[model samples]
Target: MHSPEIDNMAKLWDLIGDIRLAMFTTRHHNGHLHSRPMTTQNSRADHDTKLWFFMSRHGSPVAELTGEASVNVAYANPGKDTYVSVSGNATVVDDVAKKRQLWSKSAEAWFPGGPTDPDLALVRVDITHAHFWDVHENKLVQLFEMGKAAVTGHPAPKLGRQGEVRMA
Candidate 1:
């Protein structure tokens, strides 16, 4: 449970977990932004505001972040109509225990050496701020509301939720 008095990172974790994948964007030295799909390393632990990801140390994202840590991760679920955008500073760390903990058979396809692969690196994004949009009502109910509003010459009802989490 979360109270309005404090923004909870657990709630943010659940929201990000629901979406699963994030478009991790990083700035290149050429002053252009690049984005790549990344799977969030979801854990049961109540992380304050840090998100983890596994990637090859040789990857461009890792290289780019070495110079500038500022980055953004976007998550979207069109079917559920939920979306989130997070701004953070990413730092690469050599935490063998964490790599082992978050490891899975699926990751072996990328790093054949398994969790002990030297090329494999764990990047932690220290979230400074996060924004999310979600619809609470069922699809049918939301459609009905839209129809009603249209017939009454009124604006569409805002049936969802939106919030900003300043975690940093």
Candidate 2:
């Protein structure tokens, strides 16, 4: 990746690092979309577009993706006013290395047998593009900008940044 692309990917992580949970959405065979909150298994420092999550082997998400691989993962931080949407292809991964690598005690709540649990499966989403809105300003600054825009009858100043990242 070029410096600019690296920078953009880093920025994408910055917007999502503080948000641990993502609304992982998948399309069912019935043509309806379903979403569930899933915890990200990697940190921002990973610096990769691929995301991982642990799920039951027979879970609805696994079944849904087995039929349809396209998926979306959404991150939102209302307190920070940051939001991100990632589109990608997801699949039920069968990598024992990855399972042991990401395994933790917290996950035992769902997988009592730990990494060797037959019901445990890893879902990997290879992101194709990501759209993010990062508004890092404080409430005071945002209100001031909105006030100025209102007074001048002009659009509010976009103190933050928004853009798309194409990883594939």
Deviation (Å) of 87 in candidate 1:
1.1
lDDT, residue 71, candidate 1: 99
Q: Residue 106 in candidate 2 has what lDDT?
A: 82
Residue pairs in clash, model 2: none
TM-score top scorer: 2
For candidate 1, the 10 contiguous residues with the lowest summed lDDT are 1-10
The lDDT, on a scale of 0 to 1, for candidate 1 is: 0.86
Tens digit per residue, CA lDDT, model 1, 1-168: 566424457667667766657899999988899999988885666356788988999999999999899999999987888889999999998989888888878788889999889899899999889999988888999999999998999988788999887885
Model 1 earns a TM-score of 0.86
- The CA root-mean-square deviation of candidate 2, after full C-alpha superposition on the true structure, stands at 2.1
The whole-model C-alpha lDDT of candidate 2 against the native structure comes to 0.87
lDDT of each: 0.86, 0.87
- Candidate 2 regions with alpha-carbon error over 4 angstroms: 1-5, 43-45, 147-153
